[model samples]
Target: EFLENYFLGIFTCEAILKIIALGFLLQPGAYLRNVWNLLDFTVVITGYITVFAQTGTGIDLRTLRAVRVLRPLKLVSGIPSLQVVLKSLIKAMAPLLQIGLLVLFGIVVLAIVGLEFY
Candidate 1:
């Protein structure tokens, strides 16, 4: 718990610093303008929500803690190579989905043929 809170505090500080330096939403290169920063903001906010819920508030927001799993993905923003790879993967998704559907159709057709023969 101590370690979790420690890391949460670090992430929170980073988010605050970025927001201050880049501005929030209006500027051209604002912090929230970048998707990664938006994700970082979400993770930090969810962390606080869970902490407050567990500490003082009567609200049960434990499910929000599951979002903490995305915290590691924050590293992608720090690494340009990872960002490139991720963007490539996102671009490939539509073609990949089509290929996957084609393969599934072939499998289904073969299964139907085998059933008729048997």
Candidate 2:
């Protein structure tokens, strides 16, 4: 509990600083434009809710603790090369899905042929 709260406090402070640096009220602002900041903001809010929900209310927020794993994704967003690769992957999703389905179909056909031979 102590370690969790300690990390939460640090994340909260970091979120506050980011909000300050990005300006809270700007439309389509620097902060909103950057995916990393958005991810950081989301993780920080989730962490806060998990901490407070556990302490202030009777409801268990154990499921929300899993959201902390997303914090590491913020590092990916920070890297320009990784961002480009991620964008490329998203763009290639349709082709990838088609290839995957084709491969699955081939495996099913092979299995059927082997079964018949036996």
C-alpha RMSD by candidate, in order: 1.8, 2.6
| Position 102, candidate 2: lDDT | 100
lDDT of each: 0.92, 0.81
TM-score of each: 0.87, 0.75
| lDDT (Cα, tens digit) per residue for candidate 2, span 1-118 | 8987887788778767867887764755766567677887788889889877887989987778889888777667668898898789989999999999999999999999999999
Candidate 1 ranges beyond 4 A from true positions: 57-63
Ten residues in sequence with the least summed lDDT for candidate 1: 57-66
Please tell me which predicted candidate would have the highest TM-score against the true structure.
Answer: 1
Return the TM-score for candidate 2, rounded to 2 decimals: 0.75
Q: Each model's number of backbone clashes?
A: 0, 0
What is the C-alpha local distance difference test score of candidate 2? 0.81
Runs in model 2 lying further than 4 Å from the true structure: 25-28, 85-95
Highest lDDT, which number? 1
